[model samples]
Target chain A: MGGATFKGGVHPDYRKELTASLAITAMPAPAKVVIPLQQHIGAPCEALVQVGDTVKLGQKIGESKGFVSAPVHASVSGTVVAIGPYNHPLGRKVEAITIESDGQDTWHEDIKPHGSLESLSPEEIKAIIREAGLVGMGGATFPAHVKLAPPPEKPIDTVIINGAECEPYLTADHRLMLEKPNELVFGLKIMLKALGASVGIIGIENNKPDALRVMRQAVEGEANISVVALPTKYPQGAEKMLIYATTRRKVPSGGLPMDVGVVNHNVGTAVAMCEALHKGKPLVERVVTVTGEGVARPANLMVRIGTLVSEVLKACGGLKETTRKLIIGGPMMGLAQTSADIPVIKGTSGILALTEENVDLSEPSTCIKCAKCVGACPVNLVPTFIAQAAEHELIQRAEKLHAADCIECGCCSFICPSRIPLTQWIRLAKADILERRRQQQK
Target chain B: MQVLYAVAALGGIGILFGVLLALVARFFAVQSDPRVEAVREVLPGANCGACGYAGCTNFAEAVVGGEAKIDGCIPGGSETAKEIAALLGQEAIETVPLVATVFCIGDNRMAKDLFVYDGIQDCAVAMKYANGFKACTYGCLGLGNCVRACPFEAITIGPGGLPVVDKEKCNGCGLCAKACPRNIIQILPKGTAGHLVLCASHDRGKSVTLACEVGCMACKACVKACPQEAITMQDNLAVIDLEKCDDCGECVAACKPGTIHPRRNLPVAAPRPQDQVAV
Candidate 1:
């Protein structure tokens, strides 16, 4: 790449400085952890452990019968106190297993380290990743194993680790790169061997120069791996955008990255893979950036999965009284949390508590045909057209306009001069289009 | 002598230009099917775009091109369909007209709100707040999202803080149904008389009782009362199969919460005269 990164992307204020320099500190596991059965985008797991059953840490508590799904493990060695519905981060009640910590955090008998990465076969690495229930730890929460397993015809030769951390106020991926660069690179090498890809590249935004430098040094002698500094832009870390930025491969419309012989994973997912393979650790924890104007202490903490967001916020000095919005991820694309009682799942990267000063709750007016949203759409969608079509229930027309291709980057909503919820309406249309497609397939 | 010269020059130039213009117009003339003209002449040209085509002319072209049906226009009704069918040497197709109906029975008196929603008056905008202010998440927010969406001005926010659809004015375009954030509006086949469940809330019986008095409790009184087995319980909500519902009105009497009602304003008058169809 030359000067062009990707067409039609917005550059929001990167409020990443709030916790970019903070070291990832381990947050003490709370007394209770409510892990929802479903963490990834695939099927929701069936609770394997019953209420009152004592479980050790790293024990597979939820099992999914579907091949596309990943299993869930206990984050703490404790008794399963409840095995019913609990508040999920995505704003719904999902089946969850709550464990009251016995204060031991003891490992299960089954948790054994896989042999060295170089010694293990590709199939073994895939099995290890699958057993660890590793997902893209990027907010997408797609099962990582499924991503690694491309079809026979589509031969993948490049693996990109997305360290862009493009969303504002998110420093989880940044800190991971800074703290554990070598481990990430090792994980990337493992991914390369698994996919038989000739090259592995780590893509970090220019905003995180230290992370870029550290990651670059980590991969100094590695033959097949290197680091690339991407232009700091919103949605630069999106799968298609990152692939295009690093490999100059434009993922075709309605196609996956694998279609273009490429695969991408997040920096945090790479580190998690290293932990799963080297230390035989299951994905029980992740780095979460707890920051915003409404937080008393902005911090980057290694939070255990299933820990309630309320507990994480408490560890970060609790929320300020002016907090008006609590989000489970970054400001641009995070799901707005209605309550802190929702537990942090595998996909959560940040918990932003924004005060009224940081939020715009003004009334949305009619669109003025200002083409700012159209220009800002990275997918080259006419957001106003899609929004108007959705408003009138002209879903077929919206689908014909390629509404399903939207990445839901929220640029349209951010760029709208009249403050129309363009992204929100387009999201509604996208869902409808997908639903119609599913029906047609049936 | 001067006038003769001027006249001769002007006439000679006019004759040459007229011949050139006639030849150019003939060379560029589009060859179209005569049936397209015939169909276009028969169409009422309401240009409502309800037939999923652009305008009456476009629909006429599509019909002649075998892309559209003769009975696709709702405003033109059966008489227009018969004319178009006869013109095409095809039998007239029988299709019932449809109208929009509000599925929410929860007015201000029946339902409770969690908080005073002083936010934007639009239902979609209101839903961005904690799934809207309604205690019953499935019940109508009564912000009149459908009223504003109705192109025909058929819907109005009644005194009870619920939308009242004027059946006469509605064109059954299904826009209001889409605009209702809770999805509490429906498009159903129109009739002079009918009986239907007025509520669409899917909340459980206990929660529904706590939230709204008019919501379906899933007691299945209407189900038991329906001789045709038209009503069934789905997600604790009573759904009526319009195909089996013969407007018998027995379910209306069995519904204790007035959740089902007979068409209150009976259409005793004859339907509007069909627009003259040209064959």
Candidate 2:
């Protein structure tokens, strides 16, 4: 079937067959969990529980006064053993609450159903979503309630559920769609009702035909909701690209989706919202895809939010001795971790372990003027030029070239014939330009 | 006869163009202060921008325009300042020469690494990945961004994975200080007869001991042992006020971590001359 697609993307060796068909298995909770306060992109939460205090499952342990932040909950019923700096998946030590599990699976008393979706008001739904600590589970980890509560001037007319797990070696969204399509649709209905949106679309890549079929069947009777197949491409799951592919809308550069009267949420985020609205559950557990050439048993496992990556790897038979790289997300945009001691945060989508054969250890060479990166940039930027400007400390030149417009999809670096690390250079340029702008304002 | 005629025609055109260019040059010349040119000649042409101006030429114009002080040229130090003051018919302000000093002593043998980092060879880029894998977060990454940024080749990565500043070559332009990601390179008054705190790690006693052998543990021994009370503990690190410090080695002998050393013994300071005093 013909599918809607975007411009300028690459097709890497998608090794989804490694775990696409493997059903998501629920792993037992580890003995201890380290939950960081700043999982979402906002103000970090303040710990509400002290050491030696007992907390139940789904208990709000940390919260912040900032409107953009999300609260953290106890993933497992346990005693707070420690509260201090700990390793996070984002590569720095953040203040975290460490709990030693009591081995008893317990739920909080407040985790009761909030009645049917039709009975809840828009304001009430948003409050419930915020109280549940819902965030974009597609690795962006932007608070979901923030998107639902757009300003009065920018009204959202369409809500898009991103089901395109386009990153290589990731099948968590695919498995979630096939197994829990009803919950996904239910969450979308809640979002539409909250935002007063008319149209609801589920954009799934054509690579996962089974997921597309299941999601389509789930949305058959809904008049405003439909599942559309998207061309399997890298970063098609990005909010702007997905909006363009499915609804023919162009989100302006340096603009949010609300600027185009659209709101997008990840499919996993939808499932989490449904659970929060129906079962009064907080975001405590999520599905993490563990797969790579170095993994002994690659599978999709339902994991707790605070679970250490080392424990997850052990459950999956651990990384092989040949593993040279341990990444926290997909291969394209994932962060290469130096140690397995970091805890999984809300933004973690997968744990990828790469062997020597799967990694490229060659030094970056000079650009050959191939212009392939220019063609591969989805945002229409000349990666080569921006990278050169960044290397020479020419911030003004890089800013004039629109370095801040880069979405950091790693397409330019992937398409580079010289392996010039175009994306890293552009990232530096973006940071420098932003810093310069900040200083000028001061 | 034809050759002579061709030469005369070409020579006539050349003389006419030369006269026209001379007249244009005289008419279109822009007026500037003659002292600006003279001041630029006496200033160091490094254009290192430590004076907060664009270059030596801009600074020279600013000085002639009475907008910049004669002591603003840091690389030129007292010599250029005296010359510029003489040209401007003003008293030369006394100035002290400054040099860049690395605060970290956690070399490869003394410091521990948290992990093996094989990414870009830039300290800034490596800092983006878990603060460059150095167990002492305040320690230098030794990636040589400062070496590349130095205009006079005054900095080099020593054998210990630490930056070694050539005090003689470094004009204290502060370019290396700006290039360092950790802010470990400090510009201080040179030729002080006091001890220097060689460690920048502010971690507590336990962490400092675990990370680096030369890290300051903030045990307060140096503070108590200082005869003039020149050292003070600030955020688990020792701060030495060189102005109050005497030439005694009390703090150096009292330091348990051995992070403090004599400034004169580091191959850093030359014998202070009579004219080197800052007024």
Candidate 3:
């Protein structure tokens, strides 16, 4: 089918073969876990459990008090050893609950298997998703209920399922599609029902032919749902790119996908939604693809949230002796973690351990202005200009050049011949600009 | 007669169009707030967003509407704050003129090298691998992140592999502080003589002395030696209270390890010769 797509994107080397063939395996639980309260992109959840408080698996350990927040649940039955400031993946100290596991994989009494998605109303579905403590799971970790509920004036007509795991060395979604195709499709239908959308489109990259075939077959009988294989490209899963790819609609600058009558969910998020609705389960565990040259073993594992990254690395047969860098997500957009003590969050798709030889540690040179970043940008932004403005500390000028519109897909930095930290600079500029804008309101 | 007729017809059409334009302008003219325009005129126009607004105009509007205070611009210094205050017909608040100061004194001579850093020259990149090439993990990586972050070309890397601040060119912006991965660059008040602490390290006496020659050892010798008693120990670091310091250069003399050096280019009093020093 001739599906809609966006303009201006680059095809990076897809290195999914390392873990694509590996089926999902449940990793052994760690003894201690540090679950951060401010994992999502909103107000941090307030801690409901104190030190020494015993928490069951899937129990609400932290509760959301504001509109844009998500609740945090315990990944294992454990006693809270500490509920104070701990090391976070962002290289700063944030409030986190350190739990010492009891070795019992016990669930809370409230959790039970429900009948079907048809039984629940829109509000019921949203409550279930919220109680499940589900976020975007697409790396942003924005509250799912917030996206499901658009403003009354703007209507959502279509829901897009993003199966485009475009980042290198990540194949969690690809494996999910290949192994649990029915669950992914079930999740999509639940999301569509919750949003009250008429149509659902699962957009997968052409590189994942096996995933496409399996997903296409799963949706064969459904008239309202269809699967579309997009050209293999980076950031095709971004909200703007996905909207443009499926519906030929452009979400305006500083606007959301709902502005163009659409909503998008990651494939993992869809699966989580189905699990939440049918199994009465919370988003306690997620599939994480652990792969790279530094790792002794490369495989996809269903890991519980709040597990220390060090535990995961150990479970993957530890690291090779030369492992130089430990990243929490895909290489392109993942944050290089300072400490292995940090816990896995809802948005973490992969834990990549790269040796010194594998990591791109090349020195950054002067910008040659090759416009490679401009050519690679799917949103048609001038990344070079933004990086230049950030370098010069001209954050306002950077904002004027649409620095805030940067999806931070790392396309510019990935394609730059100068090896400049263009993405990092732009992120700093965007933060500065946003902070400045906020200060003015006060 | 034909030429005169054509000229008269064109003149009439021009007059009609001019009248229509005038009427449209009169009907659609926006009544802007005079206070906002007045406040905006006095702003520095940098629109750095340090004030938390999109631009100077938005800040001015917020100030005029009484939604914002006049002293929110950190990059504008005290002069701009006074100008903004005058524009709003409010009393000028005495705002501190904050200048970025590099806290580390561990230059090439002070710190020991680890491995020859052959990878990315960024402090952030170097930090990802074994605390950079310095024996002191907290020492400046000398990748010039501050130099790159400076908007006004106020900071540069000296030959000793440390950032040198050009006080003359510095506009007191805090961008350098944000850019430093080590958080060594600090915004201190640009005091009368530009007096401030130079040491950034918080390590103990022996370890700091071993790591870098100029690191603050938290010895408290300067605190005891100061006549004005301006220095205080906080977080295992000696900080000079700028308000109390008389610029006597006593602390400089008292610091045996040379951690509290004078600000660059400050006229330091010459030390007396040993024979002449005897009273």
For all candidates, the clash counts are 0, 0, 5
Put down candidate 3 lDDT per residue, A188-229, tens digits, no spaces.
Answer: 888888889999999998988899999999999999999988
lDDT, residue B203, model 2 = 87
Off by over 4 Å in 1: A1-4, B1-133, B143-145, B148-152, B158-161, B164-279
Q: lDDT per residue, candidate 1, A11-78, as tens digits?
A: 88888878988999999989999999999999989989888999999999998888788999999999
Model 2, residue A109: C-alpha shift (Å): 2.1
Give the distance in Å from residue A207's predicted Cα in candidate 3 to where it truly belongs: 0.8
Q: Give per-residue CA lDDT, model 2, range B80-171, as digits (tens).
A: 99999999987533366788998888876677787766655799998898878789888888888899889899998886678889889998
Candidate with maximal lDDT:
2
Model 2 vs. true fold: TM: 0.82
lDDT values of the candidates? 0.86, 0.90, 0.83
What 10-residue stretch in candidate 2 chain A is worst by lDDT? Answer: A1-10
Candidate 3 error regions (>4 Å): A2-4, A393-396, A439-442, B1-103, B108-156, B164-197, B201-214, B219-231, B239-279
Clashing pairs in 2: none
What is the alpha-carbon interface RMSD for each candidate?
4.6, 1.9, 5.7
A59 in model 2: Cα distance from truth in Å? 2.6
What TM-score does chain B alone reach in each candidate, compared with the true chain B? 0.67, 0.67, 0.66
